[model samples]
Target: MRQSDKKASFIELGKFLSQFSEKGNHLNPEVKNNDRFFDNFVSLIELSQSHNGWFTPEQVYFSVQSWAEALTESNLDQWLSRYDFTNITSKTVGLILAGNIPLVGFHDFLSVLISGHKVLVKTSSNDQKLLPFLAEYLISVTPEIASYITFTDGKLENFDAVIATGSNNTARYFEYYFKDKPSIIRKNRNSVAVLNGKETKEDLVNLGEDIFRYFGLGCRNVSKLFLPKDYDFKLFFEAMYEYGDIIHYEKYANNYDYNKAVFLMSRFELLDNEFMTLKEDTSYASPISSVFYEYYDSADTLKTRLEADKDQLQCIVSNAVITDSIPFGKTQHPELWDYADNVDTLDFLIKI
Candidate 1:
């Protein structure tokens, strides 16, 4: 199929997605393939939590709406215009998606097809429904590309290359198995925030969205905070209080109960506001319903440490406190070009 046709199909898919929201799901009769996909997708979003408790309607709608904004014709054209497609070669690219967040690995799937390569996808058990349903919508939009996408439940075969997302441990296994084939293997990494204690209440409240969205299951969620040596939590906790209703969710409340009890039993120092707990730790990955924090003496010193640990970090959220840091609450709304692990997926696909 032509590149224009490929881009158009995805843009249509985006328009279809634009109709859904946490408040409600609306169908625009003008969007093609709505009859086939619209109502069924609403039911699927409602049923998502049964498949994975973390997939609440609010979070699922946020994910759906974000993609709707991103997959516009202009955004897709701008992202694709940077690469040359004159010498393209088609290959089967295998994708091992992560289910930590809704539609987490959709970027890789989009990249392969846009680059003129077919894709064989292995959806994470945690997220199996959404992508395939969208894939069917794409085929309906452009039936000529029906053979371009496939989802497999068993071992992947007849694929020329692969892209896998998993933990640091599974990365080891992927390295050994796909070592002979060209691949991009992603590992576990967490995002962090740096606070100078001058951030406005609004800034901290937006930061709460970054921390609490997806119930803090996504790698892009801010899991750790770096504060000045003697910074106060009065304002931070107050800002976070806006999301206090999160504890009403049974799954998150259960985690809050269990992790807090463990911390109390261990005699560790903690700051609690009923819904969440804050503990001082040197680690980056914090448990659900809890956030780890550390004190830093100097911004320059923290920059050096972050540079050395960039491989283990996805992003840094700050109000320009650190260079190249993502602003508060924007991590979850990444553009099509914000490749995870700082790797250019289109470039890799074009080469293979």
Candidate 2:
């Protein structure tokens, strides 16, 4: 497709998505009561107990909006102007998706599709509806692209390139298996935060949303913190307590209770509400646990420590208080150009 045609199609896709997402209030019913666009999503989530696919309709609404704006028409044009995409074109790309987080495959799928590639998608049984939903939606907006897409559950062979996301252990498997293929294999990562102690109660509360949303299953959830050395824990915990109801869900309660018990048995120190646990650690990527804050003297010190432990962080969340150069809050909703595992996805696509 020509640039103009691609642009037009993206615009239509955006408009369609915007319209669909506005009906967020109807999503639960559409899935549970009415059976509509999200019926497959409900079924997929139900089939996979390990996957945290119980995202609020409101989250889906905002997420679809974020993606539509970031991936389509003027946004793509602007992004291309900022980054070189001349070399990325129609290629056959294989994707091995991760199920640790919901909708983790969407970014790769969008990248391949937007780059004019024929995608061979291998869905994780843990999270399947997203890919199918996306393909269906894209076909609804641009039927021509449907022929270029294929779903696979087998090994990806004879593909020009591969993009895969998995745990560190699984990453090793991928490296050994697809050694000769051009690939971007994303390993495990977790996001953190730098608390200046100057944040308002509302800011802390918003940060709580970032940490607890998705029950902390997302890569973007703030698993650790760097606070001012003399910061007051009581005030911070008070703000977090406002969100106590978030922990009432069965899955979250199970994780909290199970992990809390394990920590007690292991003689580990824990910070707890009636709902969640805050323990100390370098990294955490699942809802099962979260790391606590250790005070730092200054931003520079925090930066140095973060650099020293850079491998442990996926992104750093602040109200842009430090710098806007890094990925922050809600790690799950990646933009089209956010690039997985800190690698330039488009550049990788171009080479293959």
Candidate 3:
């Protein structure tokens, strides 16, 4: 299939996804294959939590809405405009997806196909339903796309190159396994926020979205905070109160109770607000229902530390206190070109 045809099919898939939202499902008569796919898609969204306890309707819908906004003609054109596909030879690229958040690996899948290559996807068992369902929709829109996409349940085989996402442990195995193939192997990384005491209430409230979105399951979620010395937790806690209802969910509440108890027993000082706890720590990866914070004396020194640990971080959220840091609350709403782990996935696919 031509690249234009693949882009058109994805745009159609985006339109189809635009119909479902947390507010309500609105069917558009003009969307192709809705009669065959729309109702079933709604049912799948409702049943997503059963497949994975973390895949709540609200979280899934947020992901759907984010993608609906991303896969537009303008966004696609702008993202793809930077690449040259003239001399490309189509090759099969295997994707081992991660299921931490809904459609976590969709970008890689989209990248391989948009670069005019076949995609052999091994969907994470936690996210097996959504992508394949959309793939079926894509094939329905452009029949040729069927030959370009495949899903395998067993070991991946017969692929020219590979892109895989996993934890640090599994990444080691992937490096050894795909030793000879061109590859991008990803591992666990966390996002952090650098804060000065002068943040407005609105800014901090938006930061709550970065902290609490998807229950902090995604690599882009802010799991750590860098605060100035003697930083006041009162306003920060007040801003976070906007998301206090997150504790109402059984899974999150359980994590809150358990992690809080573990901290209390360890005699660590905690700043708590009944729903989530704030602890003083240096680690970037924090448990669900908790956020770790550290005190920084110098912005220059902190920047140097972050730069030294760039590979361990995915995003740095701030209000321009740190150079190249993303704005508050926007970590989960990454653009098409905001490649994960700062790796250029399209360039990798094209070269392979």
lDDT score of residue 12 within candidate 2: 61
116-205: candidate 3 lDDT, tens digit per residue: 999999999999999999899999999988999999999999999999999999999999999999999999999999999999999999
Q: Write the residue-wise lDDT of candidate 1 on 1-352 in tens digits.
A: 8889999999999999999998788879899977778889999999999999989988889999999999999999899989998798888999999999899988999999999999999999999999999999999999988889999999899999999999999999999999999999999999999999999999999999999999999888999999997898999999999999999999999999999999999999999999999999999999999999999999999999999999989989999999889999898989899999899999998888
lDDT of each: 0.94, 0.68, 0.95
Model 2 earns a TM-score of: 0.84
lDDT of 3: 0.95
Q: Compose the digit string of candidate 2's lDDT tens values, residues 106-215.
A: 77776676666788999887767656776775666567877778988778866888998888899999998888888888887877788777778887877787787666
Q: Report residue 195 deviation for candidate 3 (angstroms).
A: 0.5
Model 2 bad stretches (over 4 Å)? 20-62, 69-72, 83-89, 283-289, 319-321, 325-334
Which pairs clash inside model 2?
220-331
Question: TM-score rank, highest first?
Answer: 3, 1, 2
The stretch of ten residues in a row with the least summed lDDT in candidate 2 is 25-34
